[model samples]
Target: TLQPDVFGLVEAARILCEDGFAVFPYTTDDLIVAERLLAAGCKVLMPWCAPIGSALGPINIMALRSMRGYFPGVPLIVDA
Candidate 1:
């Protein structure tokens, strides 16, 4: 029952980063969310290949590729 508060994520990440914590956000396969997380000072990104517990691997390879293209230097981990 521990769900992410998506709306407050950026601000929370910002705060954690400012306090010298490394923020690794678990994100969906969305470039915009990745961008925002990066902007908010996330050190690494954990983007899901599919919905949690779906067992479908790399469902959106294009989106993962896009994230790599957009953030070549940032570390991206495939989740779910």
Candidate 2:
């Protein structure tokens, strides 16, 4: 399935956050998107390590590592 618009996603997350919901957005392995989601009040980030259900584990180790480095205390669940 095609991904939703990033702007819309952030807006939705922001709204849900305002309503006191913890948002955990499933996202591509993109640091910029992760940053935006965090700013929009997402509690956790679920970044894809590979295409969904491909059984490829940790295809982008550097990206995952980068996320960890960028977000020291934030939880980053691999969404493979």
Best by lDDT: 2
TM-score against truth, every candidate: 0.83, 0.84
Per-residue C-alpha lDDT of model 2 across residues 1-80, encoded as one tens digit per residue = 54446677778888998899998887887888888899888879988888766776779899899899989899988776
For candidate 2, what is the TM-score?
A: 0.84
Task: Extract clashing residue pairs from model 2.
Answer: none
Q: Which candidate leads in TM-score? A: 2
Q: lDDT per residue, candidate 1, 1-80, as tens digits?
A: 23345658778888898898998887776777777888888979888778776676768889889888988999988776
Reference-based lDDT, each prediction: 0.79, 0.83
TM-score for candidate 1, residues paired by index: 0.83
